[model samples]
Target: MAFASVPNGNNIRNEDKVNEFLQNKSKSMAKVYLYMGIGLLVTALVSLGVGALFAGLFSNFNRVDTAYIAENALVAYITTMVISFIVLLVDGVVIARRAYSSKRSLWVPYIIYAVTMGVFLSTFLIAGIDFYTIGEAFGISGLAFFAMALIGYKSKANLNVLGMVASGFLFCLLIGSLFWGIFYLISPTLVYIFDIVASFAIMAFIMVMVAVDTYNIKRILANGCEGNVVLYCAFIMYSDFIAVFIRILYLLSALKDK
Candidate 1:
């Protein structure tokens, strides 16, 4: 008589593990996206409300018709911005890292950072960038973000190498762009070229990072990272989205000029 084959115990256990991972995957992603979405909302509201007041006060300086006035104001503005950027970078890095250490850190510091960033973004009005262009860039950014994020989440390839390389490139690009930007008054023509190049470079870097970050977040959840780490991941994705959004804004501004 032929005996019925028994189910392999190891295979059954492995199958169960996969099902558990798939089930928990949705919940993990929901938590991350929820935090990121709220952060974006806060930033948007802050930028819009604060931007209006800033635009009115600085309207005379940003008038493109008067080269002398605009260039002078822009030089000073760039210098101030460089300083602000440094402070924001340092503060954001310091606070964001703490999310791993303290649960309370996931809330207040992140909000403060988002609000401050919004205030910084509002200063873009001094460059004569309109809300329409901002909105258009934001729309493009959202689309790109979702596409890359989806690809990253579904992909099985390890993106750790790409993430590391992209981080280095981003740091170098930041320094190069800021250094070049500070000289805009001296050579507007050259600055335009550098701006175009930098915009494209930054956009490419941000795209790769978005995919890498998304993949890593899913992988981390699979390995069972703590709840607070989920907030940190959201903060990272929030930063990636902002980077892409700001780069899109730059490209839009450049195209509009032409």
Candidate 2:
């Protein structure tokens, strides 16, 4: 009597399908990183160009006059921030709906967002922050981002809970900061101290958000997402990275002043 052979064909086919899925997920993740890097580069270049142009224009002014110019620059910066915030809100809706049929449609909003961010960030230069402090802040931010991103990629534990906690904390922090700003004239010292503490807290929150966002992007790709999804993921990560960097720079500048 001949024993019946075990059927291994189905097992092999299933293994092949799993491998293919993994390969596609990896490619998608790589694309997300690429887009994020490009977005950052664009922001950096625009910021540098704008900063240099303003610096040249202000080079001939006296100290007191320069202070006046700086005050005006701060107003412009705040206005840019408000406009950028509104643009970001609209962009989020568009990305969620995948409203862009062509690549240009997607790119226009992304580029606008990056340029606005750069214009806002150029205010730091007008504020007279030295190059050394800015460089150190960038370095620290880069290391923190990479470390958190690696942990997010390697860990098996679910990060959804962490993401929720971060969101709650951020909401509270923003509300507190708003109140502090309103009462800042009443107690400048207390408000300044609170601002310092808030800066550190915000940096930590954004770093965790970077990890959470990375994990979410990986999850989305593994679930077979494609098309403009990569742009959306890149935009989220880029925003987180920039926020962390700015907070770090602010904290460093505060410490340096002391």
* CA lDDT of each prediction against the hidden true structure: 0.81, 0.79
Q: lDDT of model 2 at residue 82?
A: 85
Off by over 4 Å in 2: 1-7, 63-93, 96-105, 171-193
Looking at candidate 2, the ten consecutive residues that score lowest on lDDT are 96-105
The superposed Cα distance between candidate 1 and the true structure at residue 131, in angstroms, equals 2.3
lDDT, candidate 2, 121-233, per-residue tens: 87788779988898999999899998998878776788879988988988998888778766687888888778777777877788888888888778878887776777778
| TM-score for each predicted model, relative to the true structure | 0.74, 0.79
Return the top candidate by lDDT: 1
**Superposition error at 196 for model 2 (Å):** 4.1
